[model samples]
Target chain A: MTELVKVKNLHKSFGTLDVLKGINLTVEAGETVVLLGSSGSGKSTLLRCINFMETPTEGRVYLNGEAVGDDVNGKMRYKEADLCKLRSRIGMVFQHFNLFPHMSVLQNVMEGQITVLGRRQEEAKDKSMAQLQRVGLAEKASEYPSRLSGGQKQRVAIARALAMDPEVMLFDEVTSALDPELVGEVLKTMRQLAEEGMTMICVTHELGFAYHVANRVLFLNQGEIHEEGQPQALLKTPKTQRMREFLDGHALFKLPE
Target chain B: MEWNFAPVLGSMDILLLGLLNTLKVTGLALLFGVPLGLGLALSRLSQMRILSMVAAFIIEFFRTTPPLVQLFWFFFAFPILFGVNMTPFTTAIVTFSIQSSAFFAEIFRSGIQSIDKGQWEGSKAIGMTRNQTLRRVILPQAVKRMIPAFMERSIELLKTTTLVSTIAYTDLMYQANDIAQRTFRPLEVYTVIAVIYFLLIFVFSQLSIVVERRLAKSGEGTVH
Candidate 1:
């Protein structure tokens, strides 16, 4: 597979504190790479920077073999009209799902296709209904996100992003906010998406899902790459002392690889 | 230009004609005014500081001045200041609309800004432009959020109808004053006019509540 994204020495800070400092990583087409880190290690920021939702204080972000920006919101330099076109191949699903509360599940999913792609209302609705069916929520299309369970909302969110026909999906702790009982449903949907060969970068603490779904596991610590390898080796034989410390502290959960 | 309430009300034909004229001015003013107010509200939220400042200044200027004073300024002073004379009807509509727009703009601006920053980022990530989000996502949500305030503002605008009398416009209050002066029944005639104003505004308030309930029932996640 070809490399789809590359980050070099990315640094970001809010006020006096640094979140991501001198970080580097690469993602290839159709690859599901999970970033495993405790909170505040800048894993979420790294995901956000890739999508231009958060500007890196200093660094380069390359998507599809072109440097998108050095420091701008990174999204601003692209043709405003074509901005969503780029993101169509790369979707981001938040921890909360972030589905618009005022819209129905169908409208929430249909928004990008209709508003950004300029699909006709009927055409978008048809496509949205199909996407909902794929996620097994066709019956709930008319319902609001507030009425759905956490797993259902995340599934709806996954379908919403899928309606745009994106090749890569970013999951920022997609199941983090879910109840433990609800976690399995969202993970199951994600496992299904991964099996279909969609390139994804997920920031998650759920190492078991990461071990099963990810092609390569990246461990980030203090805004830098601590180590990375096939999931089993990273879990059983961490090469660095920092990776060891991370693994030692995380062993209690045995929840992450 | 003269304050002659005498014989104006006794001639029912003339009073009725004046009342008709009043509706024409008020109705047309509101028809276009509401949209303009929405536009002004959008301008107030523009990222450009100078644009927002100018919009804010315009709203504040109109909101602070007394409506009667603003009416005189638009009607009598504006023409000489700018070397143009406008009809009183034109002036009344212009002034009333301007007044209404300012309040509506501020009310709208506050409601729109209340949404979480996360919503904008979320919309942008999915590839919707600012305008698309506003129309498809933001404004629909904001409109429901603003229904109660909208009713309050409507009542204010209805009360403001009396200000047209200052410019010698023959609205309901103007007709009341005419009847009061003629029959020497200032208390009775004015009291009757107040009752009519109360009835009209009360009906409007009840209508908004019905609309609000319908909105809430439809899974809009709004109370007002």
Candidate 2:
């Protein structure tokens, strides 16, 4: 299987403080990689760097064998227009549902397609409706985002991303801001996408979802991959003391005997 | 001396004509200023060093000086400097548009800046270019917030037009002053002019509040 995303020697820093320090990783096509880490472990930063949302201080990121933020005449850069095109193919869902509050749910889904992909209005509408239906929000299309529940809004955000038919989707602690009761609906939508073979890199603390959905789980600590393996094995027997201690803090995960 | 109200009543037509000029000047200035203010505000926030500095300098210069002084300068000095003579009406319009645009630009900047940064990031994440993001996402929200401020500036612009009388422009104040000098009834002439200005401005202020309420009811201002 071809690697869908490749990160080589990725390092990100804000001023004097380092966020992602010389990290290297890859995601094969159709793979679901769950990134688990304590706060400040740079999981979000790593995800952001992949899209060049926060430009990596040093490193190269490749998506589908095409280099992103490439060096142009000794300067690391991607042209503004080119960067926008690259970003569209890699869908990102934030922890907070960043749906355009001024627009109705259907419009939010339709906007990127119409503006970026240059789809005809009718075609964009038809596709947006289909994606909204997939997320079970077709009825809420006419309503603005402020009117939706947190779970419903996040689902809409996912549908908005899905309408782009992105090659890969990145989830940044998408359920962290939701109440416990509201978390399941969002996870269910994500699970359906993973099942249908959408390549995904999720930064999440939802250990249960990570255990069930992820093909590989990389446990991050202090800007490095401290431990990684198949979820069943790693969660069952953590290889490092830090991983064990981190897993121990969340005693909620029941071991499957 | 028996107080006579006949002169004030007789010259009511001139004052009414002057009122029309005031309304005309205010309307024209708003038509010109609002869009120019938006452009100026955007330039002030632009990434280009020279453009932002130029915009900042112009905005600061206009905002700090009194409109009366600016009007006098434009009416008296500008023709001398540029070697092009303009009618007093055109001069008044030019002066007010420049002066009020600074106020409007500052208002626009505050309204635009008040929008949450997350809105900008979200639009960018969805693959919108900066201009597209601004046109589609930011301005729609900012424009709603700017209406009341725009109306407030319009009221100020209306009042400022009275200063044009200093340059012999035949606005309501000029007409009133002319009548007072002829009739020597300064108190009565000034009082009538003040009452008329109050009524006109009061109507606009009420209109502004109504529009603001409707916007609130339509759920435009509430951020998600």
* Candidate maximizing TM-score: 2
* Residue B216, candidate 1: C-alpha displacement in angstroms: 4.8
TM-score of each model, in listed order: 0.89, 0.96
The DockQ leader among the candidates is 2
Candidate 1 CAPRI level: medium
Residues B33-86 of candidate 2 have per-residue lDDT tens digits of 888898899999888999999999999999999988998888889999999897
On a 0 to 1 DockQ scale, where is model 1?
Answer: 0.55
RMSD of each: 4.1, 2.0
- Model 1 agreement with the true structure over A12-117: per-residue lDDT tens digits: 9999889998888889988889998877888999999887677678887778787763335543354555555566656899987788988899999998998788
For candidate 2, what is the interface RMSD? 0.9
- Model-by-model lDDT, in order? 0.81, 0.90
Off by over 4 Å in 2: B1-3, B218-224
Model 1 stretches with alpha carbons more than 4 Å out: A69-79, A120-123, A239-252, A255-257, B1-23, B213-224
For residues B29-79, write the lDDT of model 1, one tens digit per residue: 677667878988898898889988888998999899998898899989999
